[model samples]
Target: MSISLSIHGAAHTVTGSCYLLQSGRTRFLIDCGMFQGSKTLKALNYGDFPFKPEEIDFVLLTHAHIDHSGLIPKLVKHGFAGPIYATHGTIDLLSCMLPDSAHIQEMEVSQLNRRNVRRGRPEVTPIYTVQDAESALRAFSPVTYDEWIEPAEGVRARFWNAGHILGSASIEIELTTGLDSPRLMRLLFSGDIGPEVTSFHPVPESPQGLDYVICESTYGARERPQMTLASRRDLLAAEANDALKDNGVLIIPSFAVERTQELLSDLLALAKERRIPRAPIFLDSPLAIRATEVFMDHADELEDGEAFRHAMRSPLLRTTESAQESRMIERIDGSHIIVAASGMCDAGRIRHHLKNHLWRANATVLMVGYQAEGSLGRILQNGTRAVRIQGDEVKVRARIRTLDIFSGHADGTALTQWIEDRGPVSRGIILVHGEEEGLTALHDRLAKKGLDGDRIFAPELDAVFDLLAESPSKRERPAPRRLQPEVVGQLDWHNDLSRLWLDIEEELEKAADDKARRVVLRRIRRALENERS
Candidate 1:
């Protein structure tokens, strides 16, 4: 029997994690995630899936992060009717997250259609609706950690705690290859490994001794300083104290799931200790508020569970559920904290808050999550003097601060250690879910550690491989890809155009007189004409 594996997403970039495996007569997917990052990547979210959805047997979800599980509703909307196997915690989070994702798309598309109408362009529809997300919810089948299950004939799989989020997991599979000889092939998919020390869970764990292992390299090129819980909280308290001084609004663009809850717990702890002022902290995103409730329900499984529960219920923590309430936050007059979602500031209420407060020198934007390349958050982090937000150019006078201590993924050193712990693999290690920098760094690090360089495979998007018993072999492309592998993580032309426009405006403003400005404009026009010719 021949078994083949295909990289659908998260191969050359850190978003849209998916893998398709085909064995004998069975075909299944590891994850059916949505694409996030540059416009070129996000465009894939609206395009057709490379494979037929109806032919997929089932889906094995890694976690509830939109980058990993966002496109499930779209899959269901198309024709997939198979059950989605996930942990109970993942299911609970997805129950709210999927619908929230659909609603956001619906709202954004509706607003976009209005603009399109004025421009006389064709109307565009959302990829999936709230009803479609509701329909997808019915297909979830919960499973427990460390339990083995057979989703198809000759296939046995088990889930291990990845410790990245509330219910994140790394999957292990055992496949029967030869019926007469009765041979077994083992593979492990390391879904986003977490740091060694975190407030919510323990270090990531998984079984060793596999034929082939697929690992995520989200932070494979960067290394973070080791920090204990108290130390991490101390850093947060300091940042919060400094930002809240002189009646400033501290805006933390946070992830809705685990990151928000973790920050809330730490902030409340600091306030109780009198380390930071007990300013009213507003949870402004409806999706984050709902996710926090799920965290509260599962507090018993976390470290310092009682403290987390207590922190979540504190009077200083105010959750704004309605759009009107969220808008009302801008009218407040005192120093406070606002925790909003879409951590990368690519979408959600964070954009609205940034637009309202970015021009104010008294405001501070504390980024607590990883910002992908070309994301609005990255653009700000790069110190752009002015940014285009929601069709308005906003001057960036607000202070931008980044706290790397709050990342959910393990860093380079920790990722190397995690891979070392999953030892003695006979076949190969396939690296995915990262950009070229991360993938190359991890590969070199592994090679320096005496692992054969040839055994480490970093496949591009849509690349196929024949998963042989001895070693996996890369196969020729069966079809052309939706995107070139080179364009996966880099800034697209849209980002370039935005930067170019900003430069032109800055040059015009710098001109001494109208004549000088006209000269600059004439030169630009000549350049454009030359390019056209």
Candidate 2:
């Protein structure tokens, strides 16, 4: 009787979190998250699962974040029919999130196909449709936090509140071979643990007695400011006041889940006290509006219930649902705050808003969450003078501000303390859900605390940890597989050149006449020749 853990995704990257645990005759998955960020990483979403999804017994979801649960629909579409277990809050969030994700895919593919038709290229189908997402929702089985359950043979599992988002959790699983076997293994998967205290969600509880722990290191190398939620709110109010004084549009690219609710709560407080002007506050993403309702439904379970109620009832918070309503927002002429999704600004209505307002000197773009490398938000955060949005280069004259207090993940100090609280154990501590540098920093920190080098693993993508079959003391470090010769991404010249050529082709297709098309081509050719010179 042996158990093995396979790292499918989020091994050394911040997104696409999937893990497979095979215990004796039973097989199950913890997460089936979608790959996001770079084109190379996002391209992995189109590839087949390394293992057959139908063979898995069940899925144990840790949260409802798209990066953690986004690929569940794809799994179901690929023939996985087992129950997908999660907390009630996560289940409820998924009810809307999955459908929204599917809708985004539908919209993106529709746009891409239109271009493909014009260019005589083959049309591509969406990875999964809205119907597939709806079908996936039927498989959810809600479980209560802090209760143990046997979802499959020889496996017992429990969920603890992780304080990351609404109903987010860290899962603990114990597996035993048989009554005669002396071997019993326990594994803990930290599903995006949050800070010590959050205004929106309750603080997470640290669990002990784990033989092996799989933890996240998203902020393993950075420390957050020691500020209370009230102070953070004060800062937000100051920013709003400044934006209002400038008489410019305030744009916020916010996550559609917990971050939206938190921001709304603070804004509602500001509105009550008249700290901000009586301007229209638009919640532009329909997905966010639905998620806010879910937050409202679970208000009693949150930390600041009264605040949540006040935020939900705010009259200034307007929601735009239809295409016409969204378009109408672009035409409005006034000092207002618009919160849109695809938090990183890679997709969604935020791109449209950024295109319309980013060039205005009076506009302000407030970034409120983690922006992965190569994301448009990161580009703005890095102080890029201009950015390409939906095929047009937009000058970034608008002020870009990042409020780190809104982040849900715990920082370096909090993460270290969480790891230390686990008590002394001679077992493996596997790091995932972070970039290489952050993971290395965390691994070094753990080593300084007396954890042996052999016991600490920073797994590469697709690396496997054979838990039951091999002891940490005897197991050798896993080598990374050759996925490619070198990393290919937004900075890769080949990728950039291809994209530039595609943009030129699209612009030519939209030209009114051959003269205009020739003008476009000549400009491109001249630009290339100038670059060569």
Candidate 3:
């Protein structure tokens, strides 16, 4: 009659959001997200799941964002045959997203293996393949928002509009226990709550008064100014106007899903209104193009459906589907905009565009989404003078700008309000999907609002808890973790090695003569020899 919850991913970090819930003989997962960010974190993607995939009864997906649903294909590949329940919109998005994610992995691993061959290292395989992703698709069972369904014995669940993205939802789960008495345990998983004022969808809504609630805190520590859609577009127009004023190219590193669609709609609307000069805005990622089509197909469900459809169909919006066409964009001249994927600039065509344009002083890189710690986008935002891109060092002469107004997640204030609105939580609040600062800030804010500090639980990765207990109690881990919890969100040695290389080059360039450079090299060699000794 007891239930347990395990934090498999997204404990003290913003990506890789998975949770394990077990009640009696029934077992299921809330999400099977892929790990993103630091190498130490991403390494988990290639490792075995903490629990047996075959033992899992089913999965409840929050949305189609890679960080929330990317690893489902891997789960299926690993023998998980259970159905993955998601909203219709989420299913549609994943039909394209999962395959695209697999393709990226295959492509990246192929290139990595080529380099490994050159260096005599063992080749590595991708975590999953396109075929595996398609297989995962076949397992999806779509549910409509606000509808309740039973996926297992003693478990009935409902999906509510999260307002985060197309078909995004906050899941409400009811577990019935004590067969004779029929006691019910209620829980709500707030899957990435969206902001109040957004271009699409109304404010995030959910049922109030629950036994327990697990929430996301991606923007828990940061509060942004409240902006209407018009004001938000005005800001974008200003940035675009300034970036293109000197006939400069504007490169936007965008997420291929909701983020890209939102930007495309606004950009086209601005152009149509003559707020910003009309220029060919190239959608460079094939994944993004496909997602845009999904958005168009589901426009009737959105807030400004007609406007969005109009914006999406604009002639100024050009989609480059072929690799040749993508490469050809580099040969173009003048003040056009390039919207490419891998929003954090960690992968995808955005890196290629960055390598080609980052050295140009007139080019501008506009970041319109969250950039995790140690991501290339964050590094650029930190004002690094140079960065290595695809084995080539590129000077960062281009203007780097961030517009936080476009974030899908609610800000600190909005998140706090959302949590408050889901009030009268009888058991406790479990915070996940955030870094240390965010988790702490949200915890403190909740405390200030008169909630008991002890009731707010911020569990680390792989930490298990007894959900039926009077208070959240941690359980001993069954096995050692792939990486220490301390190493999850912070920069790892891989990042350090990159920085070390950059530093050495900087020092060598600063040397007055060859003799001085030789002296520096000799000192480094001596240090290495000492370490070996």
Model 3 alpha-carbon drift over 4 Å, by segment: 179-181, 473-479
For residue 474, give model 3's deviation from the true position in Å: 5.8
Prediction-by-prediction clash tally: 0, 0, 0
Candidate 1: residue pairs that collide: none
lDDT of each: 0.91, 0.84, 0.91
| Model 2: CA > 4 A from native | 178-180, 469-482, 485-495, 498-533
Candidate 1 to truth, TM: 0.98
Cα lDDT over the full model 1: 0.91
Clashing pairs in 3: none
lDDT value, candidate 3, whole model = 0.91
TM-score, one value per model = 0.98, 0.91, 0.98
**Candidate 2 least-lDDT 10 residues:** 482-491
Indicate the TM-score of model 3. 0.98
